[model samples]
Target: MSRHALGPEIHAQGTRFHVHSPDADRLWLCLFDAEDRETRLPMARDGKHAWSLDVPGAGEGTRYGIRVDGAYDPGAGLWFDPDKLLLDPYAAAIDRAFVYDPALAAPRGEGADTAPLMPKGVVTAPLPPVAAAPPLFRPGGLIYEVQVRGFTMLHPDIPETQRGTIAALGHPAVIDHLRRLHVSAVELMPVNAWIDERHLGPLGLRNAWGYNPVGWFALDPRLAPGGMAELRGAVAALHEAGIGVILDMVYNHDGESDAWGPTLSLRGLDARSYFRHEPDGRLINDMGTGNSIDCNHPLTQRLILDSLRHFVSAAGVDGFRFDLAPALGRLPTGFDPEAPLLQAMRADPLLSDRILIAEPWDIGPGGYQLGRFDEGWLEWNDRYRDDLRRFWRGDRCTLGSLATRLAGSSDIFGEGSRTRTVNFLAAHDGFTLADVTAYAHRHNEANGEQNRDGHGENFSWNNGVEGASANPAIQAARRRDIKALLGTLFCSRGTIMLTAGDEFGRSQQGNNNAYAQDNAIGWVDWTGRDREMEAYAFALAALRASQPDLQDVGWLTPGDVEWLDEQGQPLTVAQWEDPDRRCLAMRFRRSGLAIFVNGDDRPRSFGGVSVPARTVLPIPADQATA
Candidate 1:
């Protein structure tokens, strides 16, 4: 009903297609037949930068695109040409298996017809009406992050036909695993159709992580082989099992790279308004990807909001985790907590209460907005991740930092009465929990970056061995550290997220940045999983659900949680800052839960004052309790 609804509106008799090209002099609505012949139909502009047309004969399954004639210039960032067939920025369905050709990146003056290589937009059939449901997962719930393709690719119980597809997520084996872990929600990585980076094609590597999104509306065929219906069905199945589905959305940037990249959807249609460019016309590289999207633009903001509504209203996604969220909140002046886009999302009737999480940083100027988001929005606490890793890895002078993190990052999140922290020790971009203790440094040579692609400082210890070792002592120590890390996450006072295979101790051979490793290196090895670690994780999840103090809605104070020394006494300021002390104990005042962590090599004595009684509990270095 609103003018901002700029996509194809499917009806029984015909389809009304709408697009926005502010600078276009002329626009043609082109429809392709089964034989690939194009029917050129002129479109009318509303004189306000909006173009629309209704085709009575063009109903569902109609493949159409737009051809615009306008000023074409690269330096000034006004790249528009009628010759190249441009996709609908709001296309709901695209042809499967989109193939990228280098010719598409060339200037329109090159006279290269990319229509043959371009994927067409299909007019989708009207979806059956369904009632909207309330959100399932809430604050302080366990979120299991998973990549659709890599998660079930090697699953033994899933059928070969369904393996590596969205349908596989609802499989009995997969659902059973989540149920066993007591997972409240599954945060799926990007499902949007994406193009591999231009450089990866030449190097024989593929984009395993779907971070490089090209089509914001259409699902990636490789991940969602059966399209939107399959994704909806999977969400329904997960909901039936009492698990919510949260999608990781990327609106900060697209698959379209810098000046040398392809003229795909927005770049080919209207580059000036779609992307941010400097005074000299050089594109802004805020996302560290080629061109940063100008999200503040009215049309760009409309597209993003419409896409979010579509996912929730049509695809049934329960929530969204915005990747590189600061880019979306940035304005001409600076990042605003009350940015138009963020405000629109929170005020929208369809999305207000849905779970919204932010990976609150970008590579742009002043982009690290760790805990500065609006009160209701939860953030990925990278500080919590680093502090937990450093403390559990035997780094010294970390007790003070670890104490803050264990109390829901009160120093960063401000001890507010809001659910703000999504604590995680490791995520998709870095080494696995197993690799954290089995490899000291990253080994990302497979990414074709000469071993310089991933994080240089991982704070990982190899347990005295560089790689895999047959020494049982080293292996046992690694397992102990893994347990300690998992326990720390569960006992912390906030929501927790665990990467897919981390529960079973799956490793990437120390490849921290495996975004380009599409083969076995990225897939989860289910057969060789560590069953003991899996059981331990399951136990921790059970403990978290059963205990109330671990899921505190607000930040914990000294009155709520007390830090203690090995002798069951309140830790002194000097002892808290001791560089050599690696063992600590935490006792929750109300819950009386005692967590003793010994990061040292040998056994250590731990004491805690629980229930008005000072009790000293001797905890073996191997016994890291949750």
Candidate 2:
């Protein structure tokens, strides 16, 4: 059987189910009816390490699962138990979403049949493929990172029935917001089928972010009740609005976490073949998840490629943002830039032109592979996030660093002709722009870990009082700091990213790691938004979009850009080395656009431009090129 053909294939005659299990002693295909009655049939060995069975008259709408029988040897990495019904890795749809249950994790024969506790794969007929088109997005464009459910859940304009679903993204209000921000694309966080971590249940929390996935092709029913059709419609609407869609995919690990997790999928099918393990049989924790996918394995590669193609052809997404992307290139020797999987993706005709972005790091050895991916890829630049935050927070010795980031980080990207940096002030995992200026430390006591679950050093500071201060003076200072940060981000080179709700002063109450707070803490509060800040962000975006010089991804050269001091002359060596200095002007000689920055507490004038304290001033368009 073909590698990509491991899933069920339907024809007029019947449906043929194919499963790859090289080590199973036996295998069976279990079919169920509307009443939840099951009929099990033995599968005949098809090839060297696979099984197959043909059921006549069975076609779309069939609910089924696979049962693998093998010696339960944990030390040898063989975990097969027929009692645990497993989901097909290629399942496009499941009857229901997965929920945590202790019975699902019981050892072989120790627990009752798990079929009652697992979701059954539903057979689906393929939808008409979306007509391919060139992606509307490109390097140097703005990407809006969106948490589908969190972003739409509490949106007042969206009807309550459709509020939290993928369909709600197509609502007029949502599109209007993206348009105002001049977003080139919306990066939807993981919408694939996933199970919450076992620990979250006891704490009365659930995973709001869909990072822990089980089936690659299965769209989480909670997010899209209408299945792939819902995603297709949303993508079509976004495309109509001239905005592309980018799905964030997690291929590093499955929800079958650690040794104590459930066996809902790959682990029950073929553990050794599906996961990376040591010679002694322990699973590798490269992704910080219980186990990492064996990307080097051909079977794993086939599933990943098929999943990507499915979204592109079936749902019309422009591209994908890989979570913990180093896992895609990890091999037995180490992380190789030319790893087979990465090479295959670039070489594949279906995905070659689609935008490929890498998170660029994981918890594994040599995992921080910044600027290591090939020229076809763009990477998330955390260095840009930190150094800029420090500079705007009045840190010493940040003037030079600020210049470097604004010039697209020549030190990191090697001063290339074009940069692959995705600049940002804050992301989904950290403090919001408002929180960054209002909290010196994290307030994650609500996570039930006593504030130990989030980052200890966030490079943050409270303007005067930490979190929710009613002092009018303090509020004014916080607003100034946020505007300064936004100015720095919009003025920076290369592709930029802004997390959802950061523009309108959304806050997680200093909960940097609110992955489990699926409630108001994680949702974007549309009602409490600041109109002034929102308008400021929109104006910044308009300015950035209108300025051709700012959109260029290439490194700014001495002939194209000039750095000036308060005297309106080129910055002297001493001034460049002055750690206390916080005022300078970056003049784009080509377009004569000058961005004057004042990082000090006192207002200052640069070359006769009176810039307020902690503000970035862009010379008016009328006199910019004069």
Q: Judged by TM-score, which candidate is best? A: 2
Q: How well is each residue in 71-121 modelled by candidate 2, as lDDT tens digits?
A: 999778888999999998878999999998998999988999998889999
Worst 10-residue lDDT window, candidate 2: 410-419
Off by over 4 Å in 2: 1-4, 415-419, 624-626
TM-score of 2: 0.98
TM-score of each: 0.95, 0.98
Q: Whole-model lDDT for model 1 versus the true structure?
A: 0.84
Regions more than 4 Å wrong, model 1:
1-4, 415-419, 607-626
